[model samples]
Target: MIRTLPYRTAAVLAVALAVAALPLTTAPTAHADDRACEQYLHSKKYQIGPRVNQACRTAYDRGKGPNREAICKEMLLKIEVKPSHAASACRLGVKP
Candidate 1:
């Protein structure tokens, strides 16, 4: 016994399948990821490593540490990182 989809039915199914797969066929916009983090580290002369990359991701995700001075203060007080370096690195771009 042989069965086959009618041409119209098969065409409709093909279109439906294409539509269903459309989303996966395209990529979403990039997020704050590796390149941005690397730039942040390099611009500030920070050691380029996993810890620093994590810090960069955290800094970006937390929108640079609660407030402008928070990460700088935390780093200065707790991590023994210089405030100037912390601020320069954590803040990313908006100068000082």
Candidate 2:
């Protein structure tokens, strides 16, 4: 029973290590996505100014996947902005 006790303890430790690593594995993806979104909005600072820039960022936060990109594009279009700006901005915001 003493020898078996060591084996059980090692098994418990290994399981604990794996469980701790689980949450960490998914953290980088979300963080990277947010950074990408912020960088995209930041890039448009000169062309859109603060108001539209904030609007674009808000739209991006509210959206997900392709829908998020679409929302940003729509916001830009509503303001009658340049097509190139909208397209590139939305593309970067939604990029993985």
Candidate 3:
């Protein structure tokens, strides 16, 4: 039993570490996606098209951060906006 204690503790620690890391690993993807969405929203070319821009703006206004971000990414990707610029366009509003 004494010998097994260290092994059990190690196992528990390993599981805890893995669980903690899961979110961190997945966070970048979401961030990148959201950034892409924002950029698409702000681009002059996309803005020139009132219909397209309005739809995106409406969605962004209505959506929570995650949803807006995802939609932004989706729309930008659909329109072939470059990923690097996408994030800048989808800038988040600062709430008071």
The lDDT leader among the candidates is 2
Write model 1 residue lDDT over 1-96, tens digit each, in one string.
134457778899999999999998885755545345457557766556665555555556546545634543354335445566666566552232
Candidate 2 lDDT tens digits, 21-45? 9998867644324345446656666
What lDDT score belongs to each candidate, Candidate 1 first?
0.57, 0.64, 0.54
Ordered from best to worst lDDT, the candidate numbers read: 2, 1, 3
lDDT of candidate 3 over 1-96, digit per residue (tens)? 999999999999999999999998877433333224445455545553554464356345644554664565456566676665444554441111
Ranking of candidates on TM-score, top first: 2, 1, 3
Query: What lDDT, from 0 to 1, does candidate 1 have?
Result: 0.57
In terms of TM-score, the best-performing candidate is 2
* Preferred candidate (TM-score higher): 1 or 2: 2
Worst lDDT window (10 residues) for model 3? Answer: 29-38
TM-score of 2: 0.48
Query: Candidate 2, which segments miss by more than 4 Å at Cα?
Result: 3-7, 26-35, 44-50, 61-71, 77-81
lDDT score for residue 90 of model 2: 65
